[model samples]
Every structure is written in C-alpha cells, then in structure tokens.
Target: MPISRLSDLSDRALAPRLVIKVGSALLVGKEGARRRWLTALVAEIAEARARGQDVIVVSSGAIALGAATLGLEKGGRGSLADAQAAAAVGQIALSGLWAELLGSHGLTAAQMLLTLDDLEDRRRYLNVTATLTRLLDAGAVPVINENDSVATQEIRFGDNDRLAARVAQAAQASAVLLLSDIDGLYDRHPKEPGAQMIPVVEGVTREVHAMASTESNSGMGSGGMVSKLQAAEIAELAGICLVIGNGQHERPVARIIGEGIGTLFLPRRSASARKAWLGGRLRLKGSIHVDAGAAVALRRGSSLLAKGVTGVEGHFDRGDPVAIVDAEARVVAHGLSEYHAGECAAIRGLHSSEQAEVLGYSPRSSVVHRDQLVLK
Candidate 1:
C-alpha cells in the first residue's frame, strides 16, 4: 500500500458495512452529553442505512457519563472499581440516548458491551461476530462499547481506537471511520509552525508513529494518535480501509464521505472473516517450529501434522494463537492449535496411527488445520 488521497466511499462499492468509532471526548464534554452532535451523527448513519449500508457504532462515553453522575472523576477515569461502577450507571443513560436518537430516524439501537476476551477467545469472538451479523440482519444499529464495569487491565483493550478496529474486523466491515477531535494526523503537532495535515496514510511506519505520538487526548478520551495508528494496523490486516477525521462538524460523516476531510488509511484486503481474525489479532501464546518440508506443505495449503513438528515453545492450551515458524525461525503463518502445547510436544514426529497410543486417546489428526492457519 502507498499513501494517497481519500477515495469516495459513496462512489465505490468498497464495503457492505462500516464501523464508526466515537471517542469519549466527542460524546461528552464539560457540561454533559453532546446530544446535538450525536443526533446529527446518527442521522448520517441512518442515511448510510438508507443507501443499503450496514453501520455499527463503537462509542466511548459510558465511563464519562457514569463518572459525572457519581461525582468521581479523573477526566472520566477513576479507580478500576469506581470506573466499573460509573460504567454500570452510564451505560443505561448511553443506551437510552442512542435509542431516542436512532429511533427518531426510524432506526433501532442494540447495545453491546464487550471486553478484550470477547474478541480474543475464538469461541467468544465467533459469538460476537454472529450476533453482530444478526443485529444487522434485523435492521438494528449496534452501539458497542468496552465492558469497563467488569474488565481489568489484564484483559482490556485500553483504548477504543483499537477496540473499534477489532470490531470492524469481527463485523467484516468495509471501512472504519474513527471520529477524532483533530482533523487527522499532521506532519507534526498541529500547534507547531508550518504543520500540515497528511490526508492519506498508506501504512503506519515507525517514523509515522513517532511523528504523531507526541500529542495527547483531552477531557475523557483515552486514545491519541499512536493508538489510532495501532488501529490502522488492525484494519490493514483485516483488509479494511480506515479514516481518522474531525467529527466536530455538521454532518461530519457526510462531509468525510463526500469531501474526504481527513486521513484515510488504505489496506491490502482480507480473504475471509476467519483469516482476518486469525491474522489480525495481537495476542499469541506460543510458537510451533517446523522443518522446511512442513513450511512448504503449509504454503501448499496442507494442515500441520505431527510428522513435521520439531518443538513447541511457550505455554498454551488448545485454541490458542501460536506462530508457525520454519527451522530458520522465520514465522510462516499463524494458527489456532488443535492440541495443547503439552499434547503437541508429546506427539512430535509421531505418525497419526501411533499418536493415540502415546496420548492414550484419539486426538484430532491435524495439529493445526488448514482452515485455522493464515499465511504471513
């Protein structure tokens, strides 16, 4: 991918659906919820739906609203317990607001609060994906937010930018529009002299990351430019285009689609939802190293077998994400392991016919099925 101008989303049949991320700052301010802006935003969403586009909103105002109601605030953050309590309180208010606004346009709202595990664990990830597809089928716009009430640091996404990207991948959205306070990433901080906004980012490079990371979020928002870039990576892996733009304008989304008033990140594209998930997610528990023959087999779309296994490194249970590396330590692919690390270790280099005797039970023949693997 190379940097270029934002394409006309309307003029192109780019994707069947879209995921829009609304930051906490965009949704709430010093006084209260920014209902007027939200109303306009959803109106555009309704307009998109009118054009036969499925839309999902990954919003981030629960903690801000909840914190204000409870009178405990650290720019919309508090102790984990307090934040959780605030989310429990604010989510109801948030849902009610979404209901009223979307209903006014004859659109229904469905609330979904998810934590990292919801997208990290394969089974739960599939469930979330199915539910999202069903919600769209029912003509309801799903308003999603991170499950702050029960999530700990250990399993949290830490920012909605990445969360929104994950949602886009899960929903197989055509594109993602991240509504940020600033118009888009600049050559430098917008404050410095001669700072010009970069309209399109072909890819997130190390230099690009350092350029925007100096800036910080305001009010209750948590994500800054760096997180948005992180989101960009996820979008690229999913082969979904992403845009970061200022949402503080009238019919902001419309202008973004019509005039391209932001930075657009292009993508390479995904083969399927399953491959996207397997390739895009960040957490990997361990690695399975194989010989050159195994690597060739995998490239030819063969499932990983015990006969090719050399060794296993790291602690992982079945269904965990593990890197499949060749003898030279180059990662050739990523996959969900059929057997636990221990089971895999025990059956290494053994024939399928002899595996049951070693393990004392019948196991799946393939260590990593072709369907579960995504080549790098």
Candidate 2:
C-alpha cells in the first residue's frame, strides 16, 4: 500500500490486461526518420506476451511515416488536409513496419483504425469489442490507430492519446501505458532550470494540471502534456491505470511493466462492463420521449418499459440509435430501439406483454432492454 514511485508498483499486483499507446514523437525523430525506439518498444511487447499478458497497442505514427516516405517532411504548421494526407501515406508504411517487427518476434499483428463514433454507438461499440476480444483470444496483438483518412474535423479523436484511452475503456484493460518522446511529466517544462520530477500521481487535482504544458514536440502529432492529461482523465474514470513514459529507452515497455520507468496514474472506482461499453463505445443518433414516471424509474435502475414511453420522434430503424427522455424532455438514457418509428407508434401506451398483440410480431420484450439502456 505504500506506493512511493512507479517502479515500486509490481506488475503482478497490477491489472493483467493493458492498453499501450505510443505517440508519433517517439516513433520518429526530428530528422523525419524512424527511431530505434520502436524496435525496443516492440521487443518489450513481445516479452510481455511471453509472460502471458494480454496487450493492445494504440499507436500513432502514420503521418510521420507518410511524411518521411514523400521526402517532404518538415517541422512546421500545415493545413489539416495536408496532415491527413500525410497520415494516409504514413499508415501504409507504419503497418508494414509493425507487421515485420512483430512478425519477427513470433507474434501476429492486426491493424484497426477507429474514430470517435465507433465508441459512441451501442451496436458498433459491441462489434468493435467483439473483434478486439476475438483477436486477443487468438493470441494476436491488435495495433490501433485513428482513421485519419476519412475522419472529418468534427469526428476525429483529435489525438491518439485520447483515442487510446477510449480503446482502453472499451477493452476493459487493467492499465494504459502512454509512451511518448518525454520521459514523464515535470513540475515545469523539462527545459526550465528549477523543473523537478514528481514521480507518482493519485488523481487529476489542481497540482496535476499545473504540471501540464502545451508545447508540441512532433510535427506529425498534435498532442502535448495537455492532451495526455485529458486522455488520463478518461482512462482514470474507467478504472484504468495509466503510465506516461519515454519511448526512447531500450525495452521501454518491459521497463514499465517489470521495472516501472514512468509516471503512474492510479485509477478511480471501476465502471460496470455494460456502462463502460455504453460510455466508451456507443454513438447516439436520435431521442425518444418518455413520461416523468419512466424517467424516475430509469434513474432508480429500472428497465425502460412501454408505459414510460410517450412518443418516438426519431427517423431511426429498429436497431438505430435513440435517446430516452422524460415528460419534461430531459434525456434519461440512450439505447438501440427494438421497434421502429411506425411500430413504436402503434404500441406507444401498451404494456410489455401486450407488445406482441399490438405489433403482431415482437422483436424483443422491452422496447429498450436494460442491457441496451445506458443512463446519462
């Protein structure tokens, strides 16, 4: 219980499941070339697998790789589209390196590109979880990245750190390892004269935020200390521990796992699996109207019954996203509807058992099952 430093925290005592995020700054250096750091990082992951650990890597390097390939890499501000094009070019090169390196270690690597919406919609969220789980079960490592090619300004995760945190929550990992160019957070910028290293942090209090800086290190990546903290907040709320460390060190992943060479973040109370899936994975498309009594029932941990639904307002299908609201029109929860708009209209005020008689064919017992309903 006397945790003094990150290295003191035993890997055996920690969560066995993990989500590791490597930033672009660590993947490539300022000269617009691949860094030796990635070789060591992949070695660490292979070693972790040797010890029977489940690992999912959320990595950022496509844009950096793309820029290097084109020989037009520069350290300057550019348009979002320019960066996106770099990502498109880099993703191919990045995957090639990942596949080759991981394959050498006798491990298979699968590439997964995701955006914010994948984790926001209930159905798609479940699908993603299922795919990741299957890959893990088959003893293959999944390398995840943001779908920068098609992702618009509004839907992008903004940075891979935040995307990693969401992926950690979705996979219900025990911990999230954020590897970057910097070794750890500092009391001030590492370049500052009086800057001191504070090793272990418990929560996102004012003291923690004070350590964050907005300085960017890589032209290929957009995150800084601020974005890392934002990602940590999300992972912490999901009961996923995080460690921010330098990727330049040889076997950095192994050092963090066995030797603990990073700034460790403790987790808060863990969210339920269903709630985690709902919060981390599902995307909402529309809203449904409910009575005041139904809202109260939902808040009190009850299923969304037919008597509670006042009206269906969305142009969604049976499995389309919809929100459950109260008489005052406040959103109570979000879930996929069992009945479509026309079907819901036909049995708006009917009881659960009467759904079959009214619709002539019941898709599900509850209009929205408790499993599908996520409380706001």
Candidate 3:
C-alpha cells in the first residue's frame, strides 16, 4: 500500500470523528496576545463539517488571556484561589471570542468545562460522551476545556494536553490533532545547530525523550514538548492516532491532516474503556505494598491476588485511587481499590476464595483487576 500524506488524508473523506486541540500558545500568540487563528480555525472546522466529519475542539486560552486582561504579565503557577480567579476571567473572554468567530462561520459553539472527577467517574464519563455526541449530531461544535474556574487542585486535570487525551478517549475519536507553535518533535531544538525533525514516533522512550526539550517553549501555554509527548502516549494507549504540529502556519490544521507536516504517533495494539480509564483516570492516592511474587505477576499483566498483599496504607475506598507497590515500597502501578484500607489489611494474607471469611462481606476476588491496573 502507498503511504498517505497529510494533505491527502485531509482532502479525502473526513475522518468519522476528530478531536482538535488548540494549545494556548497558538491561541494567545506571543506574550499572551490573541491572534486571527481562531477565524481560520473556525473556517477549517466548518469545512470539515461540510465534509461530514464530526469534530470536537479542545481549546486552551483562558488562563493566558485572563492573565493578560488582568495585567498579570504571565500565567505562572499561583495560589489555587488566584488561578481560579484568572480562569474565571479568561474563560468568559475566551468563550465570547469563540462564539463570535464560530457564529460568523455559521457554526454554533457550546462550551463544555470538565474536571478530573467528571472524566474519572464512570457515570459522569458516559454522561459527557453522550452530551458531546448529541452536540455533534445537532450540527454543533463542542468547545471543551478544563474546568479551571471551579476545579480545585484535587480534582484538576492539571493541563490541557492531558485533558485533550481524556476527551479524545471519551469521545472515541479516530484521530487527535494537537496544534502548537512548534512544527513537530525534533531530535534537538530546531533553533540549535544540526537539529533533525522526527516525522514518526512509534512509542515514547528515553531515546525519544532526548528528542523533546524539558521546558515549555510557548509564551502563553504551560504545556511543553514533554507534556505533548506524554499526551500522545495517553492518546495512543486509548487507540487514537495523535498528530503534533504547528498552528501558526496558514491552514495548518488542513495541512497537518492533508500534507503531513508534523510528527504522528501510532496507537497501541488495542485499548479498552477499562484500560483507558485505568491509565488516564484518578491520580494515585496511596500505596498498597505487595510481596515480590505479586509484583512479578502484576508485571505479567495479572490481577492483584490478596495473598500477595503485605500491607495497605492511607485512606482509599472502593473505586478510589491507589498505587500497587512492591515489597521495597516502590510504585509499580496504580489502580482503583476493590476495598478500603482497613478491609484490605484484614484480608491481606488470605486466599481469594477466603475473602468472605476474613472481611465478613466479599466483593471481587482480585484487589485490583488487570483491566483496572495501569503499569508505570
């Protein structure tokens, strides 16, 4: 089969569904300035819609623009209260701009704000999916962003890159386009001598780690190459094709989908809702220390057996986040707990079948089922 170019793909039948993530850097420009890209972006989306492509846009600009409007100079890490205030200011301004631009293009844009809890909880996750599906079905473009205005540190998505990946997974998109200021991932910063462009990344590793600089290059975004790579890894695991490229060029979205101007990361073998949830859901809240044999079994993708658990620490209930730790107390993976810490302690050394005798009430046999566990 012949290789398909980005332009070819764009001009071809639009994908069944696509998640377009526009970074703050592109939306806010340099020094937290707004640009004309929104107009062009709306045009491209309109074109895609005309071609029968269902598109959901995950946009970042609230914090950047909010800081600028407030004369804060930059959107640095600030107190939670302060950041929330900035987001409140920015979200209002950002959504207004999107509504105006998209309206001019004869497209309606609906703002959907989300927090980590909404994506992590199974019911809420499905609800979000249903709403986006309805919006697309109604010929509306769902404009998604992290619920920064009201999200606390405990429930925040932290960054838009991660938020986009989760949204892509939830929407079950066929492709995710990550638009940034930089063209693509490079072996070294292009500004430096002898830097080479990497067109395709199969998977992220230390080798590829050298290809990305550790810091953010965007003046208006907190995301850097590292975060993009991490986001790609998450999206790939969710079986979604991820493309990274620049949004500054004329028709960059069209070019990235059509001409192939950026780096493309292929999806993994397969991804399930459970697996994607495990990998992208709740942050590790505590550690469950297990013996060596259990650690080896977990590495082999087996479920956590009660006999392997040595001790449990911290507070976590059923469906709460917890880490699977080795005897040496190193985190090997993270997953949702089947039981609380006290319950787990009572049954730590018991066999799976003997759970009822130990805990008085038995839930599932495995402490953390393989499907609910994501290895680090």
Give the alpha-carbon lDDT of every model. Answer: 0.86, 0.75, 0.79
lDDT of 3 at 208: 81
Candidate 1: residue 283 Cα off by (Å): 3.1
Question: Clashing residue pairs in candidate 3, if any?
Answer: 6-257, 6-258, 6-259, 6-260, 7-258, 7-259
Q: How many pairs of residues collide in each model?
A: 0, 8, 6
lDDT of 1 by residue, 1-376 (tens): 3324455554325556889999888888889899889989988888888888899999999999988898985944758888889899999999999999999999999999999989987789999999999999999999999999999878898889999999998898878899988889898888889999988777677677777763555746778888898898788877888899888887888777678789998875455777877776767899999988999999998999999999999999998899999998878889999999999999999889999999999969699999989876
Query: How large an RMSD does model 1 have?
Result: 4.4
Which model is ahead, 1 or 2, in terms of lDDT? 1
Encode model 2's per-residue lDDT on 1-376: one tens digit a residue: 4234555333534555678888787777766545466777788788778767788999887877776766653622155776678778878888878888899999999999998888776567778888998999999899999988778777878788888888888786777888887877888898999987666778666578888998866545788989888777767667777788877677776666466667887765455766655544324556678888878888887777777778877677887767788887666776778878888777887886887888787646777877776665
Error of 2 at 359 (Å): 27
On lDDT, the candidate that comes out on top is 1
Q: How does model 3 fare in lDDT?
A: 0.79
